[model samples]
Target: MPIVQCVPNFSEGRDLEKIEKIVQPLRCKEGVKLLNYEGDKNYNRLVVTVIGEPKKVKDAVLESIGVAAELIDMNNHKGQHPRFGATDVCPFIPIKDMTMDDAINLARELGKEVSERYGIPVFLYENAATKPERENLATVRKGEYEGLDEKFSDSNWAPDFGEAKKHSTAGAIAIGARRPLIAYNINLDTKNIEIASKIAKTIRHSSGGYRFIKAGAVEVSERNMTQVTMNLTDYTKTSMYRAFEAVKMEARRYGVNVMGSEIVGICPMEALIDVSAYYLGLENFDLSNVLETNLME
Candidate 1:
């Protein structure tokens, strides 16, 4: 059996009821397993992890996106995260016995379905991008939700599927295939967002920082603090510990304390093992040493 993982991000995270409703399709479904879900109130987003057969996973994702489109009103939505639709970005990762090409095909299938059924413009990104410019998700979502109308008006920014105009309330969505990405955040003790933003700029790749890091700052209002939120695009190239240490060192310059850190949604155990080995100064740590790794094998 082939396995594909779908991590769909929705724009509504503050309301538990709405979040549950959006994820209902993945629960009790045949050939699909709901691995995990994490919601952040400050960012007003939900990240769901599900894996199963390619067709099953694809079906569940499309159903969930439909629920999200109906329940979420992007026009009135506000959060620290950059989003353009109810179901902001959906990425399919090839897991067991699946290749990158397989994931891209799944993405295109879902994109076509969502566009035709719901009238939501879908932009295929990452490995499934139709053009080189759309390969980067950030570039596809450059203007965010508020700027979608203007973005679509320009011929250069037309979506791969559906009409050029944005959905009335659901807005637009970005669907694609990509390697595993870690959504990591380092919280700062201070409430100043500027300090967090400055540190983010120093460590993100777009600003000439780490090669595989995409970072920004967000205000966690409930916690009354700011965080350097990041997406470790390729953890193998730029591990979590490296980003953590960089943020820690930068925060010290502004007299800010490193409160703590969090990993949103599911991450590969190897990513954590790498961080553990670095922090523990392990000379020869390997997966063979992990009990669970052996058990699985």
Candidate 2:
């Protein structure tokens, strides 16, 4: 069991005691398996999921990003998802026989040990991109954290480690190594929200649409509704029943419909066995010939 799955995206989901003091260092880490959580107080963010081993899940996500860089300030952050840090966007996913160059060398050894142990400024996207325009984690979180102090005090976005700018309270972190991404969401019976923000710009992928999806559309205010959220990344190149039927066919052009769909954390088992083999034409299905998953080993 090589499994190294992490999915941390935290920007303090509406402060439940500051998200339990930023997940109390992964609840005092052991073999790290706190798998599943999804706050979303209107995208005040918190996506947490975990797994183990690759050095005990990278020492419990670098000690929960040093306790979310000592209780997450991100200069009085607000959120609608797009965040630069307060431990935002860590990735690392390799499941079993681990490789993606062993999660890109454990994401550059957890982004250079979270930029030399908490000075905070990491940014190493997609297969731990050292460059190539940072293999896009929203173009390395464009203009976020109030445009990140003139974008990392200019070394062409300086961070591959702590501070060429912003971390006065955990503001810049985005480590990587990829694959295994799911975080879905749907919700839409309509309260408009600009028809869920134009069906998240017609099914996200840098606004041209669907290429392993990556949407937006939000508004939940205690469920008044209007979402579309996504990440999907590869799900074997866009599956999850083709991203919930492509946002239920873009929420039926304004007459909206889909009111249930979510899965923010812990998603593996071939993403619910590839949506029950694309809605049940199960044919040659074989998950070790499933009999309660090989009857407890």
Candidate 3:
């Protein structure tokens, strides 16, 4: 059995009714397990994690994407996170008995079908990108939804799937195949968004930070604080502890203290173990030393 993990992010997060409706398709589906789903009202985004046989997982994701398109109108959506579609980005990761090429093919198939079914222009990103420039998701989403009209008009910006035009309501989406990523956020005590943005620019890969980090800043109005949100693209290379420590170091420079930190969805157990080793000053500690890890096997 070829197992794959699919993480799909949608643009609506505040409405419980809509969120449940969108998630209903993946529930109790044979050969697919919905691992977790998280909604951040501040970001107005929903992140769902599911793992299963590749084909079954793809079908479940496709069904949920349809629900999102029917219910969410990108024109009326507002949030701190950058987005360009009702179903923003769907990524497939090969988990077991599979290869990168298999995931890439799954991404392409889903992207094509999504375009055909919903009339949403799709961009293939990460390992599934057809062009080098489209490989980085941030580069592809630079203009966002508001700038999609201008972006679509540009010859070089033609989508890999669908017509060279934006969806009337849902906007566009990016689908791809990639390694596991950790959606991590570090909050600062200060409400100053400029400080957070500066820290984000300093730490993200494109801005000369960690090679596997993709980061940005967002203000959590409800919490009266700002956050340095990140996607730790490759946790083995750039551990959560490293990113958290970097943020703490940067915050100190501005006389801003670290408020707290959070992981949006499920993260690898090894990522947390790395953090434990650093904070506890444990020498030569690893997952092998954890009791639960041994029991789970």
Candidate 4:
């Protein structure tokens, strides 16, 4: 299958009706399967993941972006995570036979078209970064929504597409192409958000922590726990064992224990296989024997 994956972040997570209103279009979109939709209350973010034929995926995204512009306005948005738009960032990733260059081209095409149609400024990031500085997502999201006005004023931060000015309703978006990533988090057993925050600072990339780790801690209301959520950018480069162990080690110092961990959306089977091998002392174990390999199409 010439499959490409797109994960688009939209600003409205507070209202289920509103989310359903926007996602209704995806059900009718040809060649796209909504792998998952995970909404984070603290971050006020809804991440919609889908995989499909190139054109079908693009059409679905275009529709989603249009609905988001009409329904969401970034100026009034507030969340724990950094963002700059209603439909903040959209990324396309290669799966199986698809190549990174193919994903990059798809991202470029989407960025250009969305910019032209919606007037939403676009920044090409990660593997799709026009320059090395933009390769790191943390660098691009530094200012967040509050800093967009100033960021646009600087010549150095010129958008890859669209006008330097921000869109009245949608704000700006960072569209990119990247490797398969895992949205993994380890929630520490503590109500004290401070400890979780401190541990988060010590583990994320921006604070001189793990290089492939982009992370932060947020409150999970129902659980009443502060979670250290992360995007393991290159899980192949940095294993989940290392991530879990690192957090386990850091949380121990703060007098906290690992409550539990979660894989927010669909993660590649190799991640679990890698964790099993590391934890079970099966250094040479091949994952072909695992049933998950056959289960995930």
The number of the candidate with the highest TM-score is: 1
Indicate whether candidate 1 or candidate 4 has the larger TM-score. 1
Taking all chains together, the TM-score of candidate 2 against the true structure is: 0.34
Please write out the lDDT profile of model 2 over residues 150-186, one tens digit for every residue: 8877788888876687877777888888888778888
Q: lDDT per residue, candidate 4, 1-297, as tens digits?
A: 788989998998887987887776777566988888877788888889998987789788988888888898888898877888888889999986789999999999999898988888999999999999999877887788778889999999999999898888788888999998999999888988888888888988889888888888888877878898899988888888888999999999878999789998789878888888887898557877788776875
Tens-digit lDDT track for model 3 on 143-182? 8998899999999999999998999889999999999899
Q: Sort by TM-score, best first.
A: 1, 3, 4, 2
Q: Which candidate has the highest lDDT of all?
A: 1
List the global CA lDDT of all models.
Answer: 0.95, 0.81, 0.93, 0.87
Worst 10 residues of 2 by lDDT: 21-30
Worst 10 residues of 4 by lDDT: 21-30
Task: Give Cα distance to truth, residue 96, candidate 4, Å.
Answer: 2.3
How many clashing residue pairs appear in each of the predictions shown? 0, 0, 0, 0
Assess the local accuracy of residue 4 in candidate 4 as a C-alpha lDDT between 0 and 100.
Answer: 91
Total clashing pairs in model 1: 0
Determine the C-alpha RMSD for candidate 2 after optimal superposition of all C-alphas.
Answer: 15.9
Evaluated against the true structure, the overall lDDT of model 4 is 0.87
